[model samples]
Target: MTSTPLPSPTSTSGSTHRSPARARHLLSKVPEVTVWFWLVKVLCTTVGESFADWVDARLGVGLVATALVFTAVTAVVLAVQMGLRSYRPAAYWLTVVVLSITGTLYTDILTDERGVPLAVSTAVFAALLAVVFGAWWARERTLSIHSITTTPREAFYWLAVLVTFALGTAVGDGTLELTGWAPGTAVLLPAGLIVAVAAAWRLGLNPVLAFWAAYVLTRPLGANIGDWLASSRAEQGLGLGTALTSGLFLVAILAVVAYLTVTRVDAPGAVDEPGTR
Candidate 1:
């Protein structure tokens, strides 16, 4: 008596097969989302706004020059991040920090220097982001940040991230231009929007949709926070000045990064640190 023949190669079990490349990619490249993730991200975007201003105006570096410098920094650090096999807080955040600055400068050039209308810039960035996301989804079939373990997916992820920062810059500035709202008041809107997104997420909204919605809102919220802290009271801010504001946020970000490094609280695939929310 012989055993029954095995199922054909097209069976559902084949669905789990992995290529060597994809197997290597199984080591996640991004950080686990946590409270610290949002905290540092907001601070990074804040520095993106205030630090760019300090370099351009306070230090007299000029916008184009500062943009060029940060663009170069982004390229370099992004290379390092791409080379890494696993999540590294320092390199990952460095890319984000530089990307934030680059994105902000880009919007500033379009609006302030080239005299492009804020509404137009907002529309353009929105279209560009849509295109990138469309391409990314068409190719990978998914945009969840959790799946960014492969090179192609990682590239798509970063491209989307860059566009998000740029889009956020445009939206944030456009909101202020349209309403003529003060930083104190301007921030309230995005802040409210974020709270609403969080509530929706808790109330069974799609986690991915909620995550991205909050991600985009955070850019404007963080940028407004930067402006509010750096701008003079005459302009509806706390009047801390850009340099001081940048320094403070930079320090706070560094401290959080250090903590994450030691505790591995945000390490991809690692156990969540005890007491995490």
Candidate 2:
């Protein structure tokens, strides 16, 4: 009747230790949580918002058709990602960028094409995220990103990320609809909430909880920022156009990912964390 010990928070190399066989078989599939991680995440989210819109508008195809195309692309990218034994910054972030686009499109389809209300979409996506989390926790007993060293854990992680993007889209757009606020003004709420969550994490909140909270908030914050740049002056945006905004963010993401790939700074088992470097 011995009890399994809970994992230590300060695990070696920022991850729970495993045997050589296990380690060799299941290299970490996620990047270390660092400033670069957050930066790229926000960039991907911004691209999710603007790029999807730009593609749909230019494709001459309907929303549902656009969604289907992206869905197929997402499946292909995710398959490639899951097949990898170790984390590659390019593959990993490419998958994320596609997933972000796919998720945003899914929400747009529900609200714009299928005529589902944003409130309903938000509630549904939130419930889906909760179910994914619950099932993951029930099976794995931990939700820490550092534990994503197996196929099942990685699957759960990706599923949770997709749902969060959809839910964030629904909530962000719903707020705009309800408040009639301009996109620039709308960005402030999620941005401020993210800051608050970070402060709470500094003040003893759980790191896992804080990370996911900030992750969810970033979708809306980035989306609103994208909208503000793309929308016309009449809409209180800078009128940069979706194409330009997407291009700028894509280049920024490439630069960051390139740095990480060359330095391996954010790779799992890296010695230096964000600030320490």
Reference-based lDDT, each prediction: 0.79, 0.85
Query: How well is each residue in 42-161 modelled by candidate 2, as lDDT tens digits?
Result: 999999999999999999798889989998999899899999999999999999999999999999999998999999999999999999999987766777777777777788889999
- TM-score per prediction, in order, is 0.88, 0.90
lDDT at residue 234 of model 2 (Cα atoms): 89
TM-score of 2: 0.90
Query: What's the lDDT for residue 200 in model 2?
Result: 86
Clashing pairs in 1: none
Candidate 1 matches the true fold with a TM-score of 0.88
Q: Which regions of candidate 1 fall more than 4 Å away from where they truly are?
A: 1-26, 58-61, 271-277
For each candidate, how many residue pairs have backbone atoms clashing (under 3 Å)? 0, 0
**Best-fitting candidate, scored by TM-score:** 2
